[model samples]
Target: MDRVDRIRERKREHLELALTEASQSRRASGWDDVALVPSALPERSLGDIDLSAELVGHRLRAPLLIVGMTGGHPDARMINKVLGAVAEAHGIAVGVGSQRAALEVPELAPTFASVRDHARTVPVLANIGALQLIAQGERPALGAEKVARLVDMVRADAIAVHLNVVQELLQPEGDRVTGPLLPALAALVRVAPVPVIVKETGAGIDRESARRLVDAGAAALDVGGVGGTSFARIETERAGVGEGPFADWGIPAAASVLECRGLGVPVIATGGIADGATAAKPLALGASLVGIGRAALLAANDGVEAAILTVGRLIDELRTAVLLSGGARPSDLMARPPVLTGATEAWARQRGLLA
Candidate 1:
């Protein structure tokens, strides 16, 4: 098969493998390690608790983002449509998978565009790989012009430049050399119409890198840390190989949120965020938003109604969590500290993040 065909095949494989149990990280995502201190006497009712949140100037009915999952294939079109419809109905943010495939093959553009086509009212995030921003061997760098086209293609409210270094390395036909990524990213930030959000695919970003990205004009950060979908594992599975040593590699989601927060940019805590309670943990740890991946994908697979049902459950649970923790809104969790233990606490202590 040619490069385009290979990409299409890989996209299909990713959708399939990600749903399997083996593709999930065996290691904890640190949500389990962080506990919210319950309010024995709650002052507010559940209806009074607000889940609405704002990120990069976009107001969301819930502090939840349906993290970018798929696109670039015929099958993905329906998936994006379903996810977009769900996000539209809820007034939340939604993202599309990397637009590289659609960029290379214009015929596939509608696949990713489906998100914006359906979710007209909410924020839509356009995606591109971190490595694509710079020259990689024979391939030319996707400079400002093409990058701007990505935003236009989806009418994206913001652009998400995904950092997937490990996923690239694990894939059979991956780009190896990531040349001077920071400067190229800074250049993109200069010309891009909307806010630039530097996101991780699965591996999390460290404090140093997070600070640098923020300095480079990143409007936000999606700490797509380990513990959710292990793209490394998914690639390995696609390669028909065993679960390698790097299967559970990278910082946990909870730790990554702590690392990225307070850097003067909003952090979207992703990875291993399965439920509203799990989603609440990151917010209490200072994350401005929580991203749901695998769980959303599973629900979308069942159809739009099923996905809406899942989202409703999550929103309800999130409201309950905020109320039980003595909060009236999602942002309130940020001030109402959570008790950190296990590796999450150790990570905070060692990183000097714990006060």
Candidate 2:
């Protein structure tokens, strides 16, 4: 098969693999180790609690985001439509999966563009792989122009450049070069029309990497840490290999959130955020927003209503978490301290991220 066919097949494989039990992480996201202090008397009404959040200059009704998942295939069109509609209905942000396939084969553009068509109001983000940009050769300026076209294709309010070295290493046809990344990312950030969000794909960014990306001009960070969908496990299954040590690799989502603290740019905590209570922990840990990935995918698979209800329930749970923690708004939840324990505490101390 040609590269276009290979891309399409990979998209299908990704969706199918994501649905399997093997793709999920066996460990905790470390949210269990973080506890929010409860209020004796919250003083604020439950109805008064606001979940509004600002991302890349767009105001969302809630601090929740539906992270990128699938595209580059015909089936993905419907999936994006459902996710985008759900996000639009809830006044939240939505990101489409990588547009490389669509870029390579213009016919697939509608698969990603359907997101913008359905979700016209809320912030819709365009996505591209870091390696894909690198593969475009030495001209960083040329890559920037292509990325700008992707933004226009989806009318994206922001663009997410995903770094997935682990996934690439595991994939049979993955790109292996690690050099020339920072400079290329810097060039893209400088020329891209919209705010650029540097993101990870299941292998969380450490403090040093986060600092470098920020320095490279990333406007935001999406810490796609561990304790969630294990891309390693998915790739292993795809390769017909049983579980391996790599399945549980990468920095835990909670630890990654701490690593990104004080970086100035807003952070979107993702990976293994199963429920609303767990989702609230990251906000307190300094993340401006939280991303629900596998959960959203599973819900979308069940049906559009199922997806909407899933998101709605999480939003309700987040609001309840805020009220119980004595906060009147989702943003205020960040001020309320969390008692860190277990491996998360050890990680914070080891990384010097703890106060």
Best by TM-score: 1
Say what the RMSD of model 1 is: 1.0
The alpha-carbon lDDT assigned to residue 93 of candidate 1 equals 97
Query: Compared with the true structure, what per-residue lDDT tens digits does model 2 show for residues 1-355?
Result: 9877888888998898888877888877888999988888897877899889999999999998899988888879999999999999899999999887787789899999998899999999899888776653443434656877899999999999899888888877777775678988998888889998999989898999899999999999999999999888888888887877788789999999999878899999998886898889999988999998888888888778888898999999999999999999877876878999999999999889986
> For model 1, how does the per-residue alpha-carbon lDDT over 93-192 read when each residue is reduced to its tens digit?
9999999998888888999999988999899999999899888888888877898889999999999999998889998888898668899899999989
TM-score of 2: 0.96
Off by over 4 Å in 1: none
Each model's TM-score, in the order given?
Answer: 0.98, 0.96
Q: Which TM-score value belongs to model 1?
A: 0.98
- The collision pairs in model 1 are 228-272
